[model samples]
Target: MNENLTIIWEKCLTFMRDNLNAAEDNTDLKKLENSFDLLFDNVQPVSLNNNNLTLLVPSDFYKEYIEDNYLSLLSAALKKNIGKGVKLWYSVMENKPAGQEKPITMNMKGKSVATPKMQETLPPSFSANVINPFVVPGMKKIHIDSNLKADFSFDNYVEGECNKFASTVAKSIAKRPGATAFNPLFLYGGYGVGKTHLGHAVGLEVKHAYPEKVVLYLSSEKFIQQFVSAAKAHKQTEFANFYQMVDVLIIDDIQFLSGKKSTQDSFFHIFDYLHQNGKQIILTSDKAPVDILDIQDRIVSRFKWGLSAEIKSPDFDTRRKIIVDKLSRDGIVLTEDMLDYLASEVKTNVRELIGVINSVIAYSTIYKSDLSLELLKETISKIAANQKKVINIPYIQDVVCEYFGIEREQLLSKTRKREIALPRQLAMYFAKEFTNATFNKIGEEMGGKDHSTVMYACDTIKDVSKIDKEIKKYVKELTEKIKQ
Candidate 1:
């Protein structure tokens, strides 16, 4: 009977998918395909009792999504596979904690079964209203828009060895907020590797679990601007009070606060106030606290007080999964060979991988071209070319090593001599300046050093260049050479 359930569900899914494919949808193809995938991945057939069929779903969100978008199509498929009089029902399982949302699914032997709400208007993944980060007009309560993006939920965040530790820490903070030791969680990583995503995800989850909590998220630049405005009007106390009053505060790109004396000082006091009050603070940065430039020692110490998680670049296996999953959601299909090629070539970060995929999809859909290996290769090369002549890690290393008159072997070696060490540091610094590779990746190319080592190298070069005229001039010369 259980096997029959799986078999029947498989047939129904196929029927529904085929029908959806044939339907004339003025809606975006990606949205249509995404909706189909949402259901295929999330819903499973439980048991048939005479004239009724029950499907297992993860939450009421799934139930509402299916009934709202695909209820009729599902009804037709059920009629085709089960019986004309059969009705569809849902058994919504318990709401799992945020970031731990792997729904238990049966092996129907088809595409893993499920539910997609409408593509564009899908509700926030959390159950509660996202805390507005502003005061609502004419309302007794203050509501501020939190600016947490809906798509950055844990459901969409791909976890792997590179990001598992950080992802886990973010999840823990989400569950307990400031109750955990990871208060003022500091997340640092290169561009688009999900430091910002995890920051917003944590804020969203905290809002979801504790609706009464005043959760707010803003960029460091935004914070700075607000502070400048406050300073202009002599409202610094109001600014500090506004932030300190929040239960959970998330700030992205904290590295931007570098060298801004007034802003950093204000934030220092606000951070201290929040931490002393047991309020949770989340921050994202491009560099680790120890290597972060121009911030006060006290503020840097506070950044290190909580847990700091480093999100490295995703590896080949993780990259491959990202290509498949992201392309699938966007309604683009690639062959195994194509997927393998992409996973290997676009190895820098997730954001770059996504950009490449989007370009391919756009070209394919517009020109009606096949997603050939040649097309994929050509697309990747063009994108690579567009990345500023691909001033990449190896090229930067070659430039720095040759300019310093050091052998490539020594530059990439464990030698700590100043001649070799400074040039190696230059290579690491230039790789960061010239390429999109993450600190972890830059470290990898520069002989298995960790991200902190990469950060330290960059920091050392920047600090030395400031006071040492010779070093400063040499850095300028190398910068021009790298661009050329």
Candidate 2:
């Protein structure tokens, strides 16, 4: 009975798919196909005839839900396969097959079987809806969902000057996907700079807008791991086949693929196949394509074929805006002064800024304390200490000179005029504080002044900044600029 039922079920599915494809859809046809697949893959026919066709589902919920939402479509498709006179009946199975370690379904031979847990360990084979494992040959179609993150949508992504262009392009790609010229949108930036966020945002947006499209976001490490597993299982062809069917493939941190020659070689073919077929590919890395080490020139050439956008550290204003948005979402109200303090102090990346925010908010809730500047300072001080600080003396000089509207040479000269002298001293102070240079080196770098003069200049700025708010403000602004 199961053998005959399986054959009839396969016939009905083929008929329905061909019929649906012929009609233009207001509904997502792929989604409907997936719903059909889920039912057919897990459920089986108990009996069939011209007058009535009865099916056995795994549980009562499955029976009822399928009858309510999918009965009409299934009935229509069945009529086309059997006849319009046939009535469809669905009921829960009285007993699951015995001696089964996993969910059991009837294979084509009328024998109950379970997909090996080992096979399930492999990455999902291509399908339209959920993460389903590949079944034995001549069985019903199974679908595994694209592993996109639900929370990583565009609505939550905070836009700033640093990532505006990249965000805009990502949105455009999401709307059109492979139809756009930015087929392989490469996003590169240092840690915590929104590259991964933007990559996931694009995939989520694509899945939301185009339900029929298969969008997969994977880290290069995971991809390599899967490829190695597939090769070990001798299912390399199946692995290649699965990825080839994806509509959009997003690989995060492609730098991780460096030094893995076999993984890179396999990915190169997959990359070529997808690109030639008009599929969209998005990649993220810590560095630009050219800067990525140990990668093949051919693979790097393909990455360069599309757009490469870099997300830099957010400027102080952008960082402040991000904090305001994040706090507003968390229902935490903080003053502008407090926000500015965070923006200026946590000057490295968005992730660290957000980490500090979460920590402080969690601490406040546990202690029943209002969020305050003191709590923020305490939270950020610990985080900032752990973070590696970047020191650039030339950048500091440029910022100081720009603030005073003096020539670069004037900032480095021996002139004692008040304007030049003050700016020069400010430059010296920043060089000593920010860089690893010795006092002698700082003095030599700044107008060939002696070590004592550099020390005096640092002392004078420190004393004046304490007494003058404007001077303090200048130092703070200059420090922030240099950090950025």
Candidate 3:
């Protein structure tokens, strides 16, 4: 009977491959086979009892993953290979928590709770072992909600020339976490360039594959806030210890650690321990490791130990694919010309591209208007006009410097004189206003100024603009000129 089950499972796998790989594309066939290897190769045939086929799985995570992701496929395969109305059962070989082993049975009936549409998405239980190393008291094991959204899967991500290299590297790292040379994979690019999305995607991939491994995704700003909280609560060692226990650590916007000495020191220790122990560490930043200012040299040097891939703004073809993928997922179809028109008009980044698509769809639905190239052109132009300017850091600096009758270098100087200080502040103000740069980034443009320093400068400018009429005039006039 067990031998029969083996033959049945093999036939099922073959059937699956044939069904999924019917396409002539070698790449698609290879991908289907690869997914089969990861998902089904480990599934061992245990026994066949009275219309129920029990399969032995490695872990409970493995069972849940198969059920959530491939239950439909597996069930159909069994019906085709075995017989109708034969259900599948899961027997975990090693279901242990804190050294206690137990057996778990999962009977996936046709009436399972999860809908078919969500089968492709991961279950929240993927974040089973995630715990906040900080803020949780007393218990060595603490629970923290994972920010890695299941919606941020690679299936949802659009692969383009700009991100193809990074995407490939990230998938490789996910398949072989901590063992790959892409340890501490550094992704850098402008805002809305999908850096954070890719980072979350990598974390989700690792979690889906290695559910037993602890994977946590926290932004650097949140890391700093937690560090501050941990310091005040006097649980610094506990915090560090908790983090060191993570098998895969993903930190976004590592540039936010700039100019922060103690946070850098703490993170450096954690990073060194994980790297030495062959655990994976992935970091995302707006700037590359070398360009990240004020971080400790040791930390910066370690960031270079692995791959550094940049995902720039999507190209024209990439943008078009993004639009198609996004709208198709939502089950909304537009004419190819409308898609191409939006693709050409919104060239900033994926975030804006999707935002433009959403706006267009909303307009069409609300006004009951048919999609047209002219309407898309009008809508995108209004968005551009609303932005008021095509301003970046350099452009803001140029406008502010020229307005103040000072050289561009004056605003970038380390030592701010009374004369140059206001101009510098205005530049930061305009940068904050006209660009999507973070405060720390604006500070970097203004010569290594810290986050708080940038906030103070912006505040001072706002206050002075209210009461000081001349400063107010400067703000109003510079704002218009920059918009121009």
Clash counts for all predictions: 15, 4, 0
Q: Which digits, one per residue and each the tens of the lDDT, describe model 1 over residues 302-366?
A: 88667788887788998988888888898888899999998988665788888888888888889
Worst 10 residues of 3 by lDDT: 114-123
Give the Cα error of residue 381 in candidate 3, in Å.
3.4
> Lowest-scoring 10 consecutive residues by lDDT in candidate 1?
117-126
TM-score for all models, in order of appearance:
0.57, 0.53, 0.58
lDDT per model vs. reference: 0.75, 0.74, 0.76
- Report the lDDT tens digits of candidate 3 across residue range 36-136: 68767778878787888888787544564565446777788889988899878777655333454545556763322221111122222332343365544
By TM-score, the best candidate is 3
Question: Could you give candidate 2's per-residue lDDT for residues 133-241 as a string of tens digits?
Answer: 2334344575656777776778878887788768867887887787654668999876788898899999888888888888887888888888787778776656677
- TM-score-superior candidate, 1 or 2: 1
TM-score of 3: 0.58
Clashing residue pairs in candidate 2 (N, C-alpha, C atoms within 3 angstroms) = 130-144, 130-145, 131-144, 131-145
The deviation in Å at residue 150 for candidate 2 is 2.1
